[model samples]
Target: MNSLTAFARPVLRWGGDPSGGAPYVFADPSDPQTYTGFDYEFAEALADKMGMQAQFVPTDWESIVSSLKRKEFNVIINGFEPTGDRAREMLFSKPYYLFRLQLTVRKSDGTITSLEDCKKYGKSVGTLVNCAASRLLEEGKYRVKGYQDPVGAYEDLELGRVDAVLMDVAGEMFYARSNPKLKPAGKPFQTGAYVVGIRKADASLKADIDKAIDELINDGTIEKIFRKWNLWDDEQVKLRTATPPAIEITTTKLNWSEGLIKLFKAAMITVLLAFGAMFIAVILGIPLAVGQSNGGPLIRALCTTYIEFFRGTPVLVQLLFLYFGLPVIGITLPGWLTAIVGLGLNYAAYESQIYRTAFQAIPERQWQVAYSLGMRPILAFRRIIFPQAFRIALPPMTNDFVALFKDTSTAFAIAVWELATAYRELANATQSYLGIGIVVCCYYLAMSLPLAHYAHRLERKLQRKSTGILSSGAEK
Candidate 1:
């Protein structure tokens, strides 16, 4: 029965990010269980024209192309621009929708009115990462901040975090248009068209999608979809007659050495964020652990509550709250600083548990021995109790430090641009995910393996010292 059902209706899987929101693919605010957008309508129409059932596969916008390459979906129907770098990695169908760059700024910002003004004044512009607008900003040497989505960039613009936002006109239409605080700074520029992306090996699928797109255009179906979404304009009529502007293939060869250097720099950021966060974790963890182990009821309750609250919530949410939510309260932290503080606070909970357990594991005899030797409580704790507890906690602490390296990838959410972000950007640009991924893995292993090995050796050496000390005490 399953086989027959599969044969009866072949599925054309198209992928996109609904979080990108509105006019492209998004949850219908009126009915979120179903998606509604020009892209969604077009996908359904294209699939129907091809005698197949449409299946929408939700994917992150950053890894959409890579997801297509992985065969997670049959085609990418997201707002993918045909670039030479992308063309080398995949086949592009006939242009589906015309698009151009729109610059948006806060209504009160009179200092920056246009892209030229942004450039002349050295203003910061925000755009989606790894997209054409970001590349254009980079080429023009403007201060550019990249967000995971258009909405984020627009939000930052409204918050005055960015002087302007340069993104696709569609982004402005859906996000900035409704916001009374933001206005289009200048006329749209940089004409481009959205195209469906298929894997390079899927020539037959490409041909079929192209045929379907042509049919949709010829039959006025595409126009109807655009009109329904209020996206139809004089510019889109050109899609019927005009070929998409030629994709300029970059002639300059990719410098693997340069790419490696960039990845190395990003890896260093990962290291620094991890180290800084872990340092904070250790500093705070010790106090919390000590408080919980030996303090009044109030102190113990506070420490326990702090530990439980941070441990229960996800680190990503904490980071987002620190970076985005805090800005609402006039507490704006830089991305890297927020990442460090967020991760530190989250991990300190676990670290405190580790320390508390180690503290408990120490026999009462140790304390009695220190007191018998006439050592003060503080001196005994510093010289004997802490040293012993620290040794017991060392292995786990090292393990947590190693894990922190990978967790630093979450910094990408707040735009710290750590090793993981570097890998994604490089992989997308070079279309060499396998090679770049292996290099990134090697970089992580390089950072982690040494510490792990040293921790093991130190643990064994400490065990030996401990055993020898016991033997000496017995002999004495």
Candidate 2:
């Protein structure tokens, strides 16, 4: 049976982050469990035109494009702009809504109003990372903070973390429109258009969507949806009246030649992130283990609190907290350093527990023997108990290294493009998520498997030595 015809109700999954709250996508205030937004309605209309039921998939905007390419959804209608870089990776539908960057600020604070005023006052602005707002900030040499989403930037403005928020006019309408505390500072700048993102390889799908969007425009269906959200504007009307060119899907053969070099470089970065994080883990984890095991009551309590705090919370949250949260306290850290510290601190908690268990498992008789030999307490621990504890910890330590290596992929949350991030980019660029996924898996395995094997071998060797046996399986 044909897959399309087999389903009772064919589902077209649309990816978006509803937490963005407002005209774009957010939980329906009337019904908390249900979603409602302009984009949500637009997706449903598109799915209806295609004779499919729209399935809303909640996704983070930072990785929304990546998620679309990963086949997590069939389309992304989350106000994705048709930028040059993204155009090359994915097919974009006709512009459904026109947007411009609206500078928003607290109404009570009138010292800064325009971009020039912002520059003069040395005011820092916040914008969504990798967006046109960010690009504008970069080109203008403005001190800008990049956020994973527009909501976060606006929230920071509310909290005085940033002086202003440079975001889409549509976003401003939803987020800052009715607020008595905030107001638009000046005229919107940097005009752009919002479009639906479709997978490049699925040219037919793109063509169908473009046709449906054009139809929606002609029949005034989209205008009704826009009006429902109170987003109808002159630019939208102009877009509707203008003729749209037919979509031309140029099917390009998947090429890995250039991607291989990029993937290798990214893999190297992953290695750096992983090993760097692990180095921090081990160097700090050992001392933490010692403190918890051998230190006085206060020291032990402090060590326990530290271990439980990190281990209790998620690594991603820790990373984001370090990167974004610290800037609030005037302690901004670079992305690479944030990745290292976040991963290291998180893993140290786990590694400390492993070391503690190993240390405790060692018999006190060994310490007694060292004392009888006239060795000092610290010396006895260093020379006798420590070696055995390290040996006992090696197996779990090896496992942790492997796990930590994989965990480094999360650094992409803070814009650190490691192996997984590289693969997502390559997959989108080449339109080969399946192929790149395999390559990335192999890359991780190549990095992790050998270490695990070696650690196992060393563990076996230690076991044999402890039993007084030779390699030939005979007694020494």
Candidate 3:
């Protein structure tokens, strides 16, 4: 405990709050990164004053509060907006920055004129789970769904899955500016204040953080930090502007199962896609491999070129090229089709290589001997080459199949339903471990058990055949 306290890691949950005021805290949609915003700069300045190296670690926004409450960190230094109710759960530093909470609907969505307008349309309200807008809507009559991050909410909104995304004024602006593909709703709802949250019991740490805020405010450091991320605009310093629910809502029990089902569905899709693609790849691969190795120089060059192209690029790029770019050039495909085709083609290229190595091991003399014995080329291969190659290829092919199954989950980007997507939906919605556990078990059983059984059977069959010859022909 002493050693741990002396070098305790101060972790802050980024992307936790919905305002997205700190551009640093907003998660990058294209990457696995979460950042700390300009407000986080002030937090770092405090660590410097205390002579402590504060290493910033990003965690799930939804679960961060519980982690902070449990003392996962010495402090929750990410910019946190504390409601009076939330204040009961955690201590608050002085309000470092005031942000305007806004209601953002697609500019094309025409119906949502105000925050209250969402109630009339029966359009689901989108917000970060546990975000301020979510809490406000929880007590109101609007159908609200809390998502894992701003991107999720924006995605749901853009897809028309939700009528509007509730965020602070600056956030809606940032998102709108960055993604010209999306249109923000007509106007924004204004809110009162946002602050940095800390464990309530840490009155000492609270004082330290609160004191830091005071210094920043007095020295203009707060102003500089917000300016850097473009949060210092009217939205950052001002607390109110346009809309908020007239009355607070009391949240109801979420169905939670709907979220679970969505998760399971996603995982199943991924498993099937990967499993399906690998099966096709393995089947198709054998022919290409055989052709490349034995089909003169021209066919070998063609096969080599195909393998290099697919293996050289990232799987995601391949998927996108097939789904998005191909349509531009006149080849239109369905989402599932794109996933299956892309995955199959890519793995086939790799599988061809794997199979080639084993197929080439058959002695060139064997083919000549078979021909000398008057066996046709096809008969020679069927009766001699393939059976031996199969035994040799078994282990490596098994290993490849195992990896391909996991790779199937990446089809989520193409909107292909799979295990990984399902778990992501579940993890975001239920915000629990249930879906994750189920997915882990499902994939493990799906990939490992069948491969294990097949390997065992193949090994046994190899022993019995001992190269598929009826007799060695040398009398024992």
Candidate 4:
């Protein structure tokens, strides 16, 4: 028996994003352990047709294709549209379900009645990053904001952050259609089809899946699954009679120059965010460290509490709360500012600990000597204690700054397109994950290696200066 034979593998593992939510694979509300959705049911049927049991593998929507490439699963059965870019990376089975683009806007908005209106008024439309809808908006030169999922895009629409959200009709059916505050701005447009993605090496499995899909369509099993989730429509009937559209292979070369330009811009954003947050961390952290080190018990306790709270929690959770949770109490900040504040505040806790340790490392005689020289407490701190502590803390602070550059990637959770996001988008577009990833690494190294080198030099220089001063003092 071949490896692709059902007897060889009793379980067919399919990857999808449960968080992509309904009409796609999502956790069943009644039983959170089990998943439900048209896609979920359809996958089960597909597996059964292949004489195997269906096993669902939860994956993030953004990296689902890459996960498939890594052989994380046997196939990807998510709401994957067969686009030219994706066609280059994986072999797709015949199209299973027809889909369309849906534009959702707030109920109170009268200005944007359609996609054209959004373009005419220059309103920002939110969409899943690197998806067909985003590509559509980009092609039209419309203001586009990319979200990781439809839920965030729709939430932003309701919160008035984005004027409208463009996504698949399947997502709209679950996320936007039921919300009273939101309405479809126009009829769904732009026809497409969802296809199962299989690795190129899995041609046998692809052939098996294609045959199963044809059988399922002919036997009406696919329609039955769709009807269970209220997803059945006239558009699906065409799947039986019509041959799945040929996967368009674009002959154009990957635009390395344009991709590099985008990466450079995004790298600059990463730099700006890292530096801005580091500035805030330094400004806030010094006082926090000082208060904790020198203040009375009550002040020390408060600082300790803040430091513990921020340090103990994950930075990604803090960012999500700052961007999504804050708006619940009527506080809303833009994505960029929120990213800065979130990263800065979280890093401040660590920075405080570093400074506190540095302060403790300074000998008590330094303060006494400054006092003996008739220096006030503030002057003594500035001229003696602080200068030495700063030297002691500089290396670690530089390390944190470098780490903060990487942490800036977490900003993508809140929709800020930093270098990592750019790289992912470029990989998605060009299907050159390794090459683009290497280029992105070089960009980060370009930004961080110089800073790291400078910090090392400065630390050595400071050590030499300190040794010279001690030598002079010993001679005196």
Candidate 5:
């Protein structure tokens, strides 16, 4: 006890989505700076039991599993379920809490009640992506629409965009409770337990966590934590008493051919998304840049505002707003269209600055020479100014194109599967993060390397031409 008290706090980091709504892991409504949830308290308690201090690591829920595989955190305990696919990748502690799926729908909608009914009628059901509920819906052959957050899913149900939302009982209870419009449609289905996902290679860590979980349950600490969050249930109480079997460790063969085929197919989508977005950005950015540079005060202000607004915000937020948020006001865009437009508009702001800078870099004497030659403003720009600016901008433009190639992965926010998403799914299933990560990185490099090489050659060619022009003038 003296040795333990003498030591400093040892931090145990666990990742979760604080914006993922209440009773799980979210910011305190009363004090946004502080986080309070069942998972939050449970993590703290579990960490204390292990002679450590719990530190909540906020992560994007969509890629949370991959984040774990990357060792961003010691464990994933944000109501994570132990699935066969996940088990192959990570070790899990005994069940800490049990939950079941709840179908949330509009109170007015009395026709739909169960997953089977929704599937038979082809109703668009909403759920969080890559979760047990979503997998259940997909495996049942139901038309499932995935959201980044359960709040968004419930919002869709409220706005009549989706017929129903399939989420965990706790999420539905916390998020949909006291809502006049939405209600839980039927009894919970597919009962499951929440387990702590640990690194499979770290068997010692897994054993430590399992021991801590047993101690928490034996001492009634886990139950008290659940009661504090008003999440105590009979199944969870039963889970505390029940003995859990040891986690089975398994290895999967690296099927490079099949993985490569899947990667190439998804990479095609990445290429299309990048090309389509880059086309719009370049086309719009040139004009916007010109306007920002030469236009009157009002036009400049408008152009500046457009550029800052898109550049200031995140691309993912814009994609989600366009694809899901707009439907609330009756504007529903297709996924591909939303991905391209959102990416294009956001990047246009950045590209405009590049264009403007390149335009300014060219000598003012060039424009004067064009005017002196009796050339009109439009002709001066087309014949002389644009060519030089294009040369200056080409390098940056190539860099931006390469950047946008990787950025296309953000399209996954709007449910467009690209290379990154492809590898995440493949890596999770095959438990081959290192191998798959290398391959995916190679795929990106394969696309960008040629563009970079060409850019390098173009720059050198232009440099030689400029030197020759200077030498000719000096000789004359």
Candidate 6:
């Protein structure tokens, strides 16, 4: 049985902190229930018409592309554009909506008029990352400050971080209606039509979804949702009246040697980055952990704060900040360096905690014996405390390898040709998991599953060695 799902964040989300003001975007507080909007209504009707169980995939908006390509959702039934380049990647259903993108700016600053006119606004134009408007910003020579979500872009505009924000016509109006500071800076620019996306390889599913859209429109369900939202404009009505065309696709064969070679290449890149980062992490983490565990007040405090800060915040942010963020401070690391440095720092912070715990778990008598045997505190810790701590942390330290392996995927954001990037590119291009992605996942499992199995083996072996009766040579 086949199922279809709609992908969307809440239509109504908030922006900006109310008190101190640092931009926030959240699902509509007024309407707390899920699937309350016109999008949900359309999804329900489409499912009924197609006779497939309708599923709603609540996403962070960031995951839309990744989730769709991962086959986590079969159909992306939100405001997605059918662009020339994207058409090469994923199949699009007949547009259910014709959206005009609007440039949003502070009502006080009134200079912009059209998409082309946005050039006068200077570099700090803001838009959602991977959005249609982002392309416009680039083509129009506007430097975009890409935000994670729509509200974040608007918040940037409001806070003066950016001169303007660009979004779909509905989002512009919807956000503008609620927030008085923001207003359309120009004429509503027609960007193009928006359609639900289906992975191109899923031809049958794509056909069924297109058929369902026609069915729902014929039965008046689509119009019902549009009218309910006050969005049933006459222009959109005319567009929908036309017959939805079946999308045609052309397929190409894989370059057997070239692809396999690239696969090996990417795998090597991923492995090297993961292992190198983990190696740096272990080297840096141990000393920091020890210093924090036994150092003077200021040094201990610094180490504790470092551990807490890195552990509390997300590693992805740190990576993005390093890759994209550090340039603001006149320090630049090439993307490759950023990947290794960020991954190393994140795991180092985590590894420090692990070592700290291992040290604390050791018996005080072990330290005393070394000290009583004419060893200095430093020598006692080096000869006695460190070895036991290493033995104690051996299992958890090995478990860290799995996470370190997964962290390599984050390099994709910076355009590093790691396995995940290849998987995404191939999945988008072929629209089939059996193509490049199946091979890539095999690579992931090839790399990770063994390390995981080894970590498990190491853990068990260490457990056995620890529990074994102390022999004359056991002290080593």
Q: Which candidate gets the maximum lDDT versus the true structure?
A: 4
Residue 355 of model 5 has an lDDT of 95
Clashes of 4: 0
lDDT of 3 by residue, 61-107 (tens): 65666667666565655445566455556786666666666677665
Per-model CA lDDT versus the true structure: 0.84, 0.80, 0.65, 0.86, 0.81, 0.68
lDDT of candidate 6 over 152-173, digit per residue (tens): 5675566565677887766666
Error of 1 at 127 (Å): 2.0
Sorted on lDDT, highest at the top, how do the candidates line up?
4, 1, 5, 2, 6, 3
Q: Model 4 off-target regions past 4 Å?
A: 1-9, 242-253, 467-476
Q: What is the lDDT of candidate 4?
A: 0.86
TM-score of each: 0.88, 0.68, 0.62, 0.90, 0.73, 0.52
- Per-prediction RMSD in angstroms? 3.8, 7.3, 7.8, 3.8, 5.4, 10.1
lDDT of 5 at 257: 96
Give me the candidate number with maximum TM-score: 4
* Clashing residue pairs for model 4: none
lDDT of 3: 0.65
Candidate 4 residue-wise lDDT at 226: 77
Residue 144 alpha-carbon offset, candidate 1, angstroms: 3.9
In candidate 5, what are the lDDT values of residues 1-476, reduced to their tens digit?
Answer: 46576268788899988886578889998999999999988898899999887889998776777898788998897888777777766787888887788998899997888877897778889887767786677556687777778876787688776899999888988888778998877788777778888888989988888889899998999889888877788767666555553322222344689679978988888888899999999989977897899899999999999999999999999998898778868887667778899899988998999999988777777788899999999999998888778778888888898899989999876666589877776675556779999999998998889878988899888776562212112211
Worst-scoring 10-residue span by lDDT in model 1: 467-476
Residue 296 displacement in candidate 1 (angstroms): 2.6
**After TM-score superposition, what is the CA distance of residue 110 in candidate 4 from its true location, in Å?**
2.6
